[model samples]
Target: MPNAAPAPGQQPAAPLLGIGQVLARLTTEFPDLTPSKLRFLEERGLVHPARTPSGYRKFSQNDLSRLKLILTMQRDCYLPLAVIKDYLADVDAGLNPPMPGAALPGGASILQTGRRLSREELTREAGATPMLVQDAFSASVITPAETYGEDSLIVLKALVELQRSGIEPRHLRGFRQAAERELGLIESALMPVARRRDPSSRVKAAELAVEIAGQLEVVRSSLIRSALSRIVP
Candidate 1:
């Protein structure tokens, strides 16, 4: 099928790939991916491939990159589609948004470089001892993974610094409990949206969950800052 021409005032470019071609390129990396999944992602507003004259979906190079990034985040990071959509929105607006759970540097877009480090590499890069990593794992501070992402490295590095202050992972075990409590609060708040159970409502519920989590984080940080101020003075 011939690709559609660029719209008025739009720059003409290379030919776009049909759905089968897109799948051919991506299936090796994401075997579980299928046409329905791609359509679902589009419905969720994560990626918008152009429509051909006969209404076939044709993906551009940019769309392919975006799909790769989305799939990678879901597969590797276990991030929800809603969170991924928010991150992609920031990227589309030309903002260098940090990865969903990681405070990476502005220039380090995971979309540009899908970096996955082995266990040994993660420990070495974070300058963390194996014991510390084990403790963190035991404390549920970091989930065990064969290959860790940048977020894991960031967490390990922070733990290493905290260890010097005599704050071991065991001391922060309650953090996981606190997180679960906050998650419970989110789930409770989303009950209204969740009751609908339709596709659109499901998407809305997911997005609302992210928004609620962000607000909870703000409150949590404020409380911590308030507590620290009393101790420092």
Candidate 2:
């Protein structure tokens, strides 16, 4: 009965509950969540709970808070797993805290304001050369568009920062390959729905891909943070 809900008046100092109790609290918010899914998340290193003497996992308050943040990102932002991981890492390092838009249900921003500049304007604003832009395009890190989107502007800004570190566009070629692989996974997941060719199906597939990507990002970020923990403390 892993999915069984807890009965009323359980002991407050229990300090640990099996997977069933954890789901009882969490499933109300995350309807599609299941034991297997939670295990999948753990397998990817997104979550780590204390093990009981009998080896059953016992989640804590901190684990709940972190799960809330991870789920919020997935339900809201359509960011890729790698990007989400980088963002969570920033927050763990006390750099970028979670945005208000990320916390409220269905409050995700389109992230449109960040792209106020046109491509030409972005190049001027970022102080990046045409060659750099071309390099980014060639690497498939930024797709060709009639106009560069807000994301493109962010990439350009990132490149500017990297330039200060003596890193050039060529150094990021592997990034494009990684992006392709992730996109392939998304496409494969969407294939069944995508074949339907209905507007709703298309929208659903896009949203699902975005959420999956966000979850993957959270997992990646958590793994990196765990690696850094030994030296950080």
Candidate 3:
């Protein structure tokens, strides 16, 4: 496995890890991650791991850190690729710019905050009640989990605010259905690569799905804005 952080007294001349090694390091946190997904991220210039003479990928410590940040933003913040790419551009340039939709430092904040959180801890951090959390799971706003991820906290917070405005979890069921429809569209688009039983093909398929999801988010946002413009003012 790739060590995203160097061990003390580790050689400065250490060789970087291959794609499989990087996957081994990241898969526990990003279970759905694949080689294709990593390549897709590279295509968008989110993280540029080095290539060997034979064109094999090699990931460095910095590359792993950047990838961890990218996945965190996607899974936790629900950000689009464009936004994450922009954030990565800043971080790569040595800037500590504020993370969009986060109260913490850009990319660096995740170092302090680990992935897992208990249900009570989640509710308290999101400023939500126990009842609201139960309601959210019951309405299928978020899948039930023994321990919630940071994304759950973010969603719960948003639900709390919506509830105050008379927009309860039940009111957002359509959003979940729409998400499933979008996921189906992504799956259909990746069918060619996804059908291949080889490891490389499987990786490529995962990456393609993420790229399509980003474009869909842009379209979804545009439609929402267009509708709001007609209904208001």
Candidate 4:
């Protein structure tokens, strides 16, 4: 058991908050956050709130800061929990850590942060013509969104360069299929963690899936590099 609440003369060092308040405070920036997701984060040992005498959760300011870090990495950066976990562990230990959502070495990052772009802005930034944009979208190389993201601009820019090499979106139709196949493999490998219905298991499953995908990416890149090693420009 812990010390009883201080008498009327004194308040705790900081006010403690209920789960509802935490959700309300954070939901504007993290719309997908829910009671279950908070519980999921708890189960992963990312944020530990204090327990009331009644066994209810009570979040402190530090807890809120930790949750913000976790949610920002997940939503804005699409970081897998494992990477975020390592980052947080170092931070809690009072060390400087590499930020999350960086690309695995020798690979491209799948997510980005910054201003959202309209179609025209994306095309302008990528220096791509309307016809080329249509071709990329039609090939499903980049999914359409009301407002495009940085990744969309990157893909479009690459398509522009590849176009000058006489390679077009049609030549890259297989990329999507390859991605789906790799995803299927990762999903299959995640069956053990995915079978449980608990929040902890769900979080574990997500991290495992990303780890598996990262491994597959390394292997794919190794093969590509090996194949290119023998080629001459």
TM-score (all chains, Cα) for each model: 0.54, 0.51, 0.56, 0.54
What's model 4's lDDT at 2?
93
Q: Write model 1 residue lDDT over 38-151, tens digit each, in one string.
A: 876786688999997899999999999999998877765557676698788888889996786552477554543577899999999999999999999999999998788777
Candidate 3 per-residue lDDT, tens place, 1-233, comes to 87476578885665699999999999998887889778878876788899899999999998898899888777666566776776777877899967765756565554245467888889899898888888899889988877887668779989999989998898888888989999889988999888899975765565566668866766777899999999995
The TM-score of candidate 3 is 0.56
Q: lDDT for each of the candidates?
A: 0.83, 0.70, 0.80, 0.80
Q: Give candidate 4 regions above 4 Å deviation.
A: 1-114
**After superposition, which runs of candidate 1 have C-alpha atoms over 4 Å from their true positions?**
1-113
RMSD of 1: 13.6
State how far residue 128 of model 2 sits from its true place (Å): 8.0
Compared with the true structure, model 1 gives a TM-score of 0.54
Q: Which candidate number would show the highest lDDT if scored against the true structure?
A: 1
C-alpha root-mean-square deviation, each candidate: 13.6, 8.7, 12.7, 14.2
Q: Please list the residue runs of candidate 2 whose C-alpha ends up more than 4 Å from where it truly belongs after superposition.
A: 1-14, 40-46, 52-56, 77-79, 82-87, 94-110, 115-132, 144-185, 191-207, 210-233
Global local distance difference test of model 2: 0.70
Report the lDDT tens digits of candidate 2 across residue range 27-119: 887665677766666765677889879888888877777776666665555454445565667777888555523434464354533335566
Candidate 3 at residue 112, lDDT? Answer: 41
Q: Locate the minimum summed-lDDT window of 10 residues in model 4.
A: 106-115
Question: Model 2 misses residue 68 by how many Å?
Answer: 2.6
